[model samples]
Target: MNQDKRQILAQYEKSMTWVESLADVTEEQWRTPIEVGKWSVAEVIGHLIPWDEFVVSKRIPLLFTEDSLPKAPNVQEMNANAANSSRLQSKEETIGKFLNGRHQLIDALHHLTDEQWQHSFHIGESELTLYRYFSGLVEHDWHHFLQIEKVLK
Candidate 1:
């Protein structure tokens, strides 16, 4: 409801539109590898689900109980982890999971207080506000979305 939350929600809505537009992409296109190298559209969607799930389920709770956020893993390490995840589902399944996870993220963000929106979390040696984290999510989504769009073309 506050400005920060509103901004996050707006960015999320834009992300949702970008992702949903891929619904019309052919199955072969979904399976096509994007410029990110190892990630297909399906795998990209698979990766996104865990991010939202981590924020909504794990990281947020940790913020309330722990003194600091967990050390952020390197991007390559995170990608490797996502690649190894057995839970990565099929194209249709990943799409559905992404949609559900995105909705959950939106709902959680909507309910956070202004104070909570400004709460700080440590990622590696750096401190980040919830707003920065949300902005990071938006940046990540657009980065992957552009890669996917290029591959689809």
Candidate 2:
């Protein structure tokens, strides 16, 4: 595989492994916010789940078709809802949902042809590639992982 594909696969691995690393977090810690008015550790992982589904169901498929991409999701409301909805879940349930979505996304991505790695699509003001879009999610995963760490601290 090319460098970009290697990087893409690496990110997927990193995202899953990073989450798995947190499997030992106590239930109390899962609900505690890393900072005031920020998402709790569970909420943050809940938020990450939809982005993966979006990539698999919307973003990835858009590349192989002529249809226009859907408008971006409402982040603030989505975040709020995800957190609220997941608040009552057991730690295992929350983590299971996250893992299911992540695996679904990774599976969808694995079927892409080499040419699809370089596939381009427009999002808002920018034209971006499949590789760039997925890489951004990797960064997104790290951003949350860091937040979860700070909460643990």
Candidate 3:
């Protein structure tokens, strides 16, 4: 694999380890919001599960194909439901779900050929390469990771 793909895959692998470590944190720390009126650490991690599933099941199959990409999901509803689920579940359960979903995404991405990484596809009116798409997701992961880390500290 190229450096870019390696980097993305490494981030995915690193995320699993990072989240697994959160299982050891105190419940109060796990549930603390990163900022006033924002999502708690658990909720922030919880929200990632469905997004990974969406990328694996919905986004990957349609990309680089003749078929049109599906419409975007309702962000508010999906996020609210995920956050609620996180709030109701144990920290271990929430982290387990996140790890499972992320593993599935990593597996799907591993199957893609190097050629596909560079292939451009249109999402609605915007065109982007698979590498770019995954790169954006990695950036999203870092954004949340920082939020959780801040709250933990």
Candidate 4:
């Protein structure tokens, strides 16, 4: 409900508007791999799930239960794993899962207090507040959304 959290939620809402508005594309379109080379729409959606899940279900809880940020996996390695994940899913299933995870992220952001938003955590060598993490999520959404749009074209 603070300004930072409000801004993050607004950004997410806007992004979701685009994500949710995408419709009528054939399954072939969704399964078409593009952008990050081997990543299809299904894989992109699959990739986003753990990120949203991490922010909502993992990081937030760690803010209270643990004294520090949880150990993060290597970014390059994780992307490699996503690329290799054979469970690419159907268009409907991928989109539905993304929507569900996105809603959970929004709900989690809505509940954060001002202090929590200001709390600092380190990712690699960079220190970030909760708001920064929210911004990162927004960036992540847009990055993949553009990839999806480009592939559809």
For each candidate in turn, the TM-score is: 0.82, 0.92, 0.96, 0.81
What's the true lDDT of residue 89 in model 1? 52
Instruction: List the candidate 1 regions with Cα displacement exceeding 4 Å.
Output: 64-66, 71-78, 84-88
CA shift at 47, candidate 1, in angstroms?
Answer: 1.1
Clashing pairs in 2: none
The local lDDT score (0 to 100) that residue 79 gets in candidate 3 is: 90
Give each model's whole-structure lDDT: 0.76, 0.81, 0.90, 0.73
Best-to-worst order by lDDT is 3, 2, 1, 4
Q: Mind giving the per-residue lDDT tens digits that candidate 3 earns over 70-97?
A: 9878999999999999999999899999
lDDT by residue for model 2 (19-111), tens? 877679888898888789877888888888777787788777776677887876898887778888779788788888888898988788778
Model 1 clash pairs are none
| Candidate 2 overall lDDT versus native | 0.81
Q: By lDDT, who's the top model here?
A: 3
> How much lDDT does candidate 1 score?
0.76
Best by the TM-score measure: 3
Which scores better on TM-score, 3 or 4? 3
> Considering summed lDDT, which 10 consecutive residues are worst modelled in model 3?
2-11
Query: How many residue pairs clash in model 4?
Result: 0
Please list the residue runs of candidate 3 whose C-alpha ends up more than 4 Å from where it truly belongs after superposition.
none
**What shift in Å separates residue 76 of candidate 3 from its native position after superposition?**
0.9
Error of 4 at 35 (Å): 4.0
